[model samples]
Target: MKLLKTAAVFICLTATGCSSLNHEPSSSSPSTRSAASSEKSWWPFGGKKTAPETAAKIDEAATHAWLDAYEPRLREALKDSKFTLERRDNVLIVTAPVDSSFNPDRPGMLMPTTLGPFSRVAKLVEGDSKTGVLVLGHADTSGQAPVNRQLSQERAQAVAAIFRLSGLRRDRLLLKGVGSDMPRAANDSREGRALNRRVEIVLTPQHTLMALLAQYNTPAKAGPVLAVTQTK
Candidate 1:
């Protein structure tokens, strides 16, 4: 049974029988950071993008104003979807599905950024909102730790590429490959391992966004009182 679970996680191939989707990673996002040299390629899904200068140059308070308005609207875009949102404190946990097909290496592994979620992310940046950091993580359990780590990070890059299509400044997003250092579930079990393979999107602090909101909320100071004129 566990073996079947293992096979199931290999949806890219085993998917002949099962549907073209796997719902894992809702458990815990896997994030791993490692350094390795690899050839760089242009994003296939959509062309690279950059945020407007106005969006880029702003304080946290002002950005937050944009965020305050953008967040709710963004939520609406993601409503009733597979991507789950778990917000704690100021961080937003986006457990969005990625299309494993978009992965770079094809023969051995199947990693693609799920299209649905990617589209949603693009919408956020396309709008007139504050810019911030976007960290991408790929979670997988196929190859050994070292290889899987690289794969996970590559998978993350794939998602970031899709976001780049939306036209946000590449600088606003810090693209890295976190090979599966972080696991949401146990790797011992097939189901656990599948759950481990995922992309964890954390909305790290975007001081620009915050500052924008502050200025937006700060009310204008009252003007000084005028001197009374004598009518008599």
Candidate 2:
């Protein structure tokens, strides 16, 4: 799946036009696009009121710019793993497999060790304050509700740990572990299952977009700042 996400990233789309690999043409829709992105996204989750300051980043150029900013730190954080970088329709996408070399245990919940990094688009679903929740894409209702919820929560926790490791405050990023009750893809096929196995990260408006926006604009003047930069 990580390999697929990398292949389908923005740049790959531009070069090869492999559109079917992702959710749908709608996944590239306007509403889900980042509010601060330069181009207009077809983000299915976006509102019509997306103004100049709150525009969707639908174009590949804008998404690339966004990823350009985080690549340095992200690369370093996962430097040892094979990383696939993709830019498609203005979305900076990355796919990296979990390195058993780094940590051998399977997450309490099974999902992508490295979720494709369109996570940049995860903005405050509501007014900021750092608190947010996302459903596990893979969870389904066929299983027991309690087990599903736990599974969901585990996926959330794993992603939350990742966010914390990435410097997101524990208080700021929240997760609710909604299980298979909600699914982004069909329950059939290996491809569908792979697509569904994901963790979504979201931010709230209680916090301002300034920090992310700032990072997006700067594009990290060098390589791998996450590991190399002194953590104060």
TM-score of every model versus the real structure: 0.53, 0.36
Error of 1 at 210 (Å): 14
User: For model 2, how big is the CA root-mean-square deviation?
Assistant: 16.7
Tell me how candidate 2 scores on lDDT: 0.35
Top candidate by TM-score? 1
Candidate 2 TM-score over all chains jointly: 0.36
Worst 10 residues of 2 by lDDT: 223-232
Off by over 4 Å in 2: 1-67, 71-142, 162-167, 181-184, 200-232
Write candidate 1's Cα lDDT for 1-232 as tens digits.
6545433344333223111221222332332222221222112123432222332343446434544655676577667666666543334446654433433335223333345555576657645334454444455556765666555555555455545556656445544334444456667887776666666554534544322222211224111101101000
